[model samples]
Target chain A: MSIKQEELEEIYAFAVQLGKDAGAILLERAQERFDGSKQAEQGHIEKVNAVDLVTQTDEDVEAFIKSKITKQYPSHKFIGEETYSRGVSRDYLIDDEPTWCIDPLDGTVNYMHLFPMFCVSIGFIVNGKPVIGVIHAPFLNQLFSSCSGKGAWLNESQKMPLTRNPTPPLPPNAPSGCVFSCEWGKDRRDQPDSNLHRKVESFFNMASEIGGREGKGGMVHGVRSLGSATLDLAYVAMGAFDIWWEGGCWEWDVAAGIAILKEAGGLITTANPPADPATAAIEEVKLGSRLYLAIRPAGPSANETGRQSQERTVREVWRRVRHLDYSRPGV
Target chain B: MSIKQEELEEIYAFAVQLGKDAGAILLERAQERFDGSKQAEQGHIEKVNAVDLVTQTDEDVEAFIKSKITKQYPSHKFIGEETYSRGVSRDYLIDDEPTWCIDPLDGTVNYMHLFPMFCVSIGFIVNGKPVIGVIHAPFLNQLFSSCSGKGAWLNESQKMPLTRNPTPPLPPNAPSGCVFSCEWGKDRRDQPDSNLHRKVESFFNMASEIGGREGKGGMVHGVRSLGSATLDLAYVAMGAFDIWWEGGCWEWDVAAGIAILKEAGGLITTANPPADPATAAIEEVKLGSRLYLAIRPAGPSANETGRQSQERTVREVWRRVRHLDYSRPGV
Candidate 1:
């Protein structure tokens, strides 16, 4: 059943507060390590060998969030990063009940390094669709929140895109003026056909000179790898990043981001185009696909609606990027 | 003649204020574009092809800074990004007189995209060595400054590394716990022997598993590309980034950063290792070399001094990275 606006607003407020509380905890723990304390010196060794400290923090944060959520909503389903990694079945991802998909510490590696790109993400899904989202980056002092009907916001004051007005339309020649973001994920094998190889090749193509590199050149304005999928998605929602595509991350990583991005008028789809891309509509992919392509919101244009602009950008990106394969663990 | 402590302090204070003022000017111009104003819409088209708007701002900022500096120090030689780009001899870079090296607006691409990584950087060089530096990133609300004898600082309050105490020693395995930063610069040719190709391969080698990829892997903890060399250098000073290696950028791009990095107890050398890696001293590279490798400050270790740890880390990285070629424009 569809929830009323009042209930949605309440849920949104709760999630935002939860995100802030969790982010504060993370910052407290991270501060000690960042200051090169004796404890941090010891943890540095653990980080290199086993990531023990990060794991401990991740588990603590996840448990903290889960306890609060369950206390408030005993019937809600839960999917969390630390718990899922402990061997939860993928089937829980498709449950029809109101589900809380949370990544307590999204950029564990960045946090471990004290790089300041980590965050706490909370996404509320109803009937397999994300309806509310909240992300808090304590170091950045940014809190992004959104609900199904209400618009997206940053810090509860500035709106998404930070434009104060409508978002500017996509560049006339898409990707030419765009600021694209992608990641060199954990999988770093160097085989000629490995996903890492494909990623490297794709990054090269996008950054190459236009009409150079034998039709592979995209000549996009710039490419960034921020090491946190959640932060990348959050920035995309703000219209600072025009496009983002990646593979091999889990559902919790992008769930909240997807909710915020949609509320900001952006579009999300599979990294790979459809079989009949010419005529088929570009539909959003299942949350478990482990592949994603997100483009910023499009303002009005002379020839087409905002949706058309987004779809055409996706098609153009697909033509330039190689097909990436990322299968779920059990699928 | 060497500058006294009193004179150096005066110069440092002046440079910091100048950086802040220039940063404010840049932020004002950038704010109009970031808000999707009617002016930004027209500038968007110019950005795609001619980059006229960015060039105009870059020139304006440079002129504004130069005018101020000349009025204050009538005899100080100035080497600015805009002026040097127009065709200045490399010989001026080695002048014995006190020189002000400035990039009024660094990370032009990031500024044009409203990406929040751009900044103003100013360096005071004397006797061919950078003695004082200041960098102001208005969007990030960060100001980094340093002098030869004095230590580096962030926002004039927190010391570099943000560590209340001494920096932690380097990891026993060097690259294992390091956060490495690099950029895919403007030269994006895909040829096998090109600098871009070598840079990409080195990035791959560093990111791969230790035993994988034909022993080319160094297994660095994480790799980031933040799109601005100055910010990368400043972060390195803060010990947030453990290592940064890059080539093909100009002296103005890194002059201020080099000063700050050194004052923070960090080390800088050529990205390419010395011919006899085991026996040679890893001396600092010349500013005009257009190549650099910077490592964060090291605290005391069990077996070696802080400098020794930095030296060994450099050698280890050089073993894993390939040589890059970046000649001057008219050399």
Candidate 2:
């Protein structure tokens, strides 16, 4: 039986509240140990061991969120950050049953360092497709939420499609005009010649009018590495960033973001676009396959010309940074 | 005669409030034009023209801050972002007298995009020395301030030196373990093998476990490019970021940050270490020479070993990405 639209809406509301609650607990824990105001006398022993407390906080928040959600939706399946970190395979769990994909704390590294760029990310998937998502950033006091067909919102007032009139594709002689976002995840397996090293090179190329290592210039204005995949995707959905290239994050990191991005009319594909578009399936998007490219949606009311401009911008980006792709070979 | 300590304190308070007031006006102007919420129907012509409004906010806030500060300290020299952007050399302005260096809006790109990483930065210099600095981030509702000899602060409550217990030096053969921050300024003079291209290559190398183009690996835990220099410095002073390497920004971008960094015990050296540190004068910091390296302060109560550890961390970082220096060739 197809789940009714109203039921998805109810689930969306429930997950949003659950995200906010989980965010609160993490926020309190972070604030208590956030800085070194009083540690002026402590030694390296204290510095080296700080991550332990932070690890516990992560586990606590995940446990709290899991208990609350499982209690409410007793039959629902749950995949959380800590659980996945403990060696669970996140790719094969989705099915016809309702699965709550959650990143109880999406930017753990940033949190341990006291940088305020983390959030609680939650997405509800039904029949292997994301139908709802909610992300709460307590430090910034911003909530981004969406349900399929209901539209996405930021802090309940600002709707998505942050820009309908994004700058048209760059003049061929000129550089692309868009803010880009990417990251260097914890899994830095290969060294000087690895795909990551190349990806980081591409990021620098995009930010510069200057050519990269091989002397090819990307010229895409600037770049941002905010250290949060979920927030990076959310910002693209809100149009703060024109595009976000992601890798290495699990299903929990991108699931909730996919729901919000879909509701906002954004598009996602493999990090490297296919030579033949017919082979790509939007429905078969792999949340943990380790390579993704996301582009901002055209404004909801954008004319056909505006939509074409948006696509042209994406095409230019793909051409310039396609060599940065590392996902396919490994897969 | 040397200015009295109490008088310096008063000036610090005055500048802090002025920074916040200017920040508030800019914040309000930004919110009014932040996104394309109701603007989805607008065309590229309109989107391209939006920068015109953003430019107005930048100049308007600068004028507002300059006018207010000039009225209060009519005899003091003043340098603002807009005036400097109009081709005034920021150097040679610091004679023996008092002069206010201000960036009415730092991170204009972020402001234009409605990203919350912008701020107002103001620093008071006396006898060619930064005596007082105040950086106010209105969106974050944070004020970081400092006067000579007095400690820096966040919101005037939490003291600076965000972490008294910094990570010890990298053990031999270990990666440079720290969170790093850098920026991509908009000056693209030469393409295909420019200094920036080399600099970006260095950044990628720092993030990798494998060595850089020159066979050096920084092995930093991660990197952040939040797009705001003033806030970047403030965060460094607050200990959130372990090191910040900046080039191409004006004096207005870093003077306030310099004062706070000094008060917090943080240190600033050129992006490239001087060939002879013995000949360098802390007094001749060259605020607008356009390259800087900021490191969090060692603890006030730490032993000699702690100080040595801090120095070692800096040494490792310097070895990793020091090719990013764009100042000397221009200096």
The estimated TM-scores of all candidates read 0.93, 0.87
Pick out the ten consecutive residues of candidate 1 chain A with the lowest summed lDDT: A43-52
Query: Which ranges in model 2 have alpha carbons more than 4 Å from their true place?
Result: A34-54, A88-91, A163-175, A189-193, A210-216, A276-284, A300-307, A323-331, B35-54, B88-91, B164-175, B189-193, B210-215, B276-284, B300-307, B322-331
Q: Which ten residues in a row are the worst by lDDT in model 1 chain B?
A: B43-52
The candidate that achieves the highest TM-score relative to the unseen native structure: 1
Give lDDT: candidate 1, residue A267: 92
lDDT of 2 by residue, A198-253 (tens): 67656665665534425545655457888899999898787677778776666788
Q: Tell me the lDDT of model 1 at A84.
A: 84
Interface RMSD of 2: 4.8
Is model 1 an incorrect, acceptable, medium or high docking prediction? medium
Q: Residues B1-331, candidate 1, lDDT per residue (tens digit)? A: 5678898899898899999999999888877765556325333324324322355778888999999999999988999988886664654354678899998888887787677788999999988898999999898788999988888998898778765366777788877668889988776666768787788888888877677668867767778888889989998898888999999778888999999999998999988766776668888878888889999888877798888888888987887888889876443
lDDT of 2 by residue, B16-52 (tens): 7888788889777766554534332222222222222
**For model 1, which pairs clash?**
none
List, residue by residue over A1-331, the lDDT tens digit for candidate 1: 4667898788888899999999999999877765557335342324324322345778889999999999988888899987886774654365678899999988877786666788999999988888899999897777899998888998897677765455667877777778889998877676778888888778777777677668767767778888889989998898888899899878899889999999988998988766766567788867888889999887767887778888888887887787788876555
TM-score of chain B of each: 0.93, 0.84
